[model samples]
Target: MHSGMTDVTFQLRYGSNLTYECSLAADRVVASHLPPPALTDLPARLSEALAAPLEFPALHQAIVPGDNVTIVLERDTPQAGALLAAVWKEIASRGVAPDHLTVLQPASYRSQPPTDPRDALPADVREHVTWKVHEPATEVECAYLASTAAGERIYLAREAVEADFVLTVGELAFDTLLGYRGTSSSLYPGLSTAEALRRSHGQGHDELSPDDQRPLRELTDEIHWLLGGQFSLQVIAADGQNVSAVVAGQADAVLRHGKKLLAETWRFEVPARPELVLVAVEADAGGHHWSQVAAALDAARHIVARDGRIVLLSELEEEATDGILMIRDARTPRDALQPLRQAAPADLIAATQLARTIDWANVYLLSRQDHDLVEDLFMIPLEDENEVDRILDGDEPCAVIGGGQHTLTHLQNR
Candidate 1:
């Protein structure tokens, strides 16, 4: 804590680069931790991993002539631009025209695609390729696939299923539903119909370990088994942009290798469980989506004391605020969870999980979202940024979380 004339000055990041200055007592400022430093030479690292993928043939050997290749990417994966450029250069050398390639990003269920395809691809290569937003929520856009053992109808995006070649690029992070975001999982929950997406995601709703694997992995296995020759490129990314480590090839193999790299980079050892957890949700586009807020709470769980306080700062700019409304409407956290268990509402899985966290801790949030709406969810709302300390009310030894969605805090002695 830095010294101030009247009070201690704590300058903390409220958004990506925006700062929040709070004045509190020096003793109350218990601890501060920064995120892991970024990896150097990101492009070369991505190129190297793509050049020699584990458990799969090299890029050229994998893609043959006349193949209609589809590259799956999430909205947040700008690094896909680099991965695509590298792969495209290789494919082009072997006479694979750019017209034969399609870049697919999972569309938000029941809505139009969230991002412009041009924004996700490299400028040099963007013009030469085709881009499609995979819409599993749309009836015509999906096809009838085999149902799960649980009897959930499996409808997959037709483009991804019908494509002659599939290569997915995504970063590894702690996912609230599936343990981690691997390549296979991207196909579904984004490319599946609304019912299938909700059913699969709602399966895991408790404290999810990074190592726990079940339905998601099993589902991935079945999908690959049914539709052979699927390839994945997984990354351990810092700040969601810089690629440090990468693993590619078979989705299961990529999942295994990516998890190891992910644990090393994203996990941190905190000295003690803090009385207060302050998490800043960076203000990227769609940064404050319900899933992201829930993920931040998940990261906080690793270091927050039982019944402690958690403060979040985010823009909450996503079009939907259903989760917040769900929390507000329920009489208690348990009441809110019942519907999520029965019917998963797209990516709003966070509302159910966030309610559970609220049951354990008092969460305070700062967002552009409606204050009444924020308060209706049983969380304390911070009106002004500077009032962070005032709301903290001298709760000392607070833990401030940056990159809340992408970070995991582990206890040093636990």
Candidate 2:
């Protein structure tokens, strides 16, 4: 789109305020996707969004006195403590006793000690709010919900099942399994029984496009509807540590608005398929990891030419997950993925997407990981920007994707 310029400069980011820059011939650049500016006053916007929700009553009006409310909190959400504090303060102000309000944490956080969102609240408010982590394996912690039309039995976290009102606070972003993740995405496998979790997420090859109708997503929606409480609050991420917008309303309405806002904020369309794609991944709170890299590669693979090159740029330092390790130790990707089809581990989806992408295209990595580890995973290790510059110097069309983990990039025709 640069009519006159011969080259365009790109400043890729990772970690807080860290950046890497390179220039490409203007004609060679086919697409560039970047996150929108972060919201300046999140608290004020949150207050306003909660006050006037879409297709639903205000949060305060929806609750009555003596109601036992459960707030399902997404632990990784940006400024989660503040979001939880705001929601809890509103519920408390409406005469709901602190003891009657429960904060239900996801099961994935059980391995590590998670920070208490109550810490962000005022001293008096923080003292009385009850918090419980979801235990899917314990029969006492889960209660029978309804069976699906397909005869699948469902069990939800006892806290949500027993609560008079349920409020889900989560983020809206692209998912490897579900097209768009938010709303009830956290409730199904997140708060359900271990069997349900495995059944829902154990698929190794059920990747869905953002616009496709995914059975997993449909099932999650059914769970949300069956659970009864409709109030939902979802945030659209702006970058690593900030959100661009917060949508609160009926579950369906909030999901619709959130999806629309997400596309407007993160979608990028290229005129045609490109031969080279450079993706930058990062998270400010904790360093980067493999899941983010996998998501970025998935997005890149969508609009990349056959046998194209995808270079993942990050400062990733975490050790590879069990699924990734399985890939490294196996003779072939299919051989490694066979076990995941039966038992979905924490990084199953990420590992599957990564292995598939490695098969589809050439994947290069620039991270803190050891060169041997990167090679074992079948990715070329990128030494420096000089290497990236050398690749860009080639005469093929290329693309740049920022916040690639959160971005959704595709061709205009497809």
Candidate 3:
């Protein structure tokens, strides 16, 4: 695909508030993909979605005067605080007292520390709302749900299980484990017991298919059913902190709507495998981490040629995990990955993905970490845009992918 210009300049997003610009030969560019323009009035769109949700009652109609409500949030989602504020205001307007509403969130939405979702609320509203982070390892924090089809016992956060109404707020995007991230995903493995969480971590969907019938998604739906979760709010994000769309209402309806919008916004098709795939992983507020980098690399690997080069640009600063440390100390990638296959840890997928990506292509990572740590992972450390400029100076076919963490690239001839 020709970029239609002699020299194409790209202002790529990096870190929280920085952008790195570079130029590429238009003829050498095989493809370029970016998210659609962000919505100009996000708050109004959110309010409209809540007021007229699909296949479910509006917020005022859904909640009664005395119902105890719990909002389960996927805290790492872009603009999560905005979503929470919109939902909370609608529910509170229905005469539901502040004490009866609780915000239950996962301990760590990403590899880095999370900003409290409730912080988006006004000071008065923030003071009255109850908030707690889910702790998967603590027995006291969980309540027994039903058993799965396999008869494996299921446990979720006590707050979510016991609430009279549960409203799930999560991001809708392609996922390695769940095919596509559904509303229920944030509640089950995210808020479930440590055992369930570990089991979920072990089930990596290497096939990368978006079929709705995948086992993990089925499990998530079943868990949502067991919890009597009927209403949900899901967001599809644009590049960086921008949100492209928001869907609200009945779980299935929201999932259906979200899936369609996700495909239109994030999926891309290339003509052929490029020799070099340049990708940018953006997290607006300092939340960029190793897991997102892994996701971006995984996306790039699908569209790059054998022994091709993948340059990943991010502002990753999260500390190394135990799995990462294992990789750092191992003699070979296989040795580092062998132990992870038995027991799933926090960084199981990330560690394995990084090792596999390096084995397939040369990965250049530009991040805030030290050169020693970058070398430890067998990745070449990228210091500045000069290195990027040097790489682009090659005449090989290249593809530039924006928001690679949420992107799904397919070769047209494949």
User: Which number leads on lDDT?
Assistant: 3
Task: Please report the TM-score between candidate 1 and the true structure.
Answer: 0.82
Stretches of candidate 3 above 4 Å error?
Answer: 1-4, 107-113, 284-286
Rank candidates, TM-score, best first.
Answer: 3, 2, 1
Residue-level lDDT tens digits of model 2 in 1-414? 123458888778864566878877888888798777789998888888888999988898999998999998875677887788778767777889887888887776223445777788778867788887788888888999898888988889989998999999888887757888888887978798877766766443244467688888999899888899699888888877788899999999998888899889988899998999988886732236677778788788888888899988887777888788878987866677777655566788788878777877888888888999989988898887677677667888888888888888777876
Please name the candidate that would achieve the greatest TM-score relative to the true structure. 3
What value does the lDDT take at residue 60 in candidate 2?
A: 89
Write down the lDDT that model 1 would get.
0.69
Question: What is the Å distance of residue 62 in model 3 from its true position?
Answer: 1.2
Compose the digit string of candidate 3's lDDT tens values, residues 273-351: 9999999888843267777788889889888998999999888888888777777888866677777776566778787
Q: For candidate 1, list the clashing residue pairs, or say none.
A: 30-397
Clashes of 2: 0
Q: Write the per-residue lDDT of candidate 1 for residues 243-359, one digit (tens) a residue.
A: 667677777788777777777767767777888887776643334467777778767766788889898877664554566566677898768777656655654566766877788
Note the Cα lDDT for every prediction shown: 0.69, 0.81, 0.83
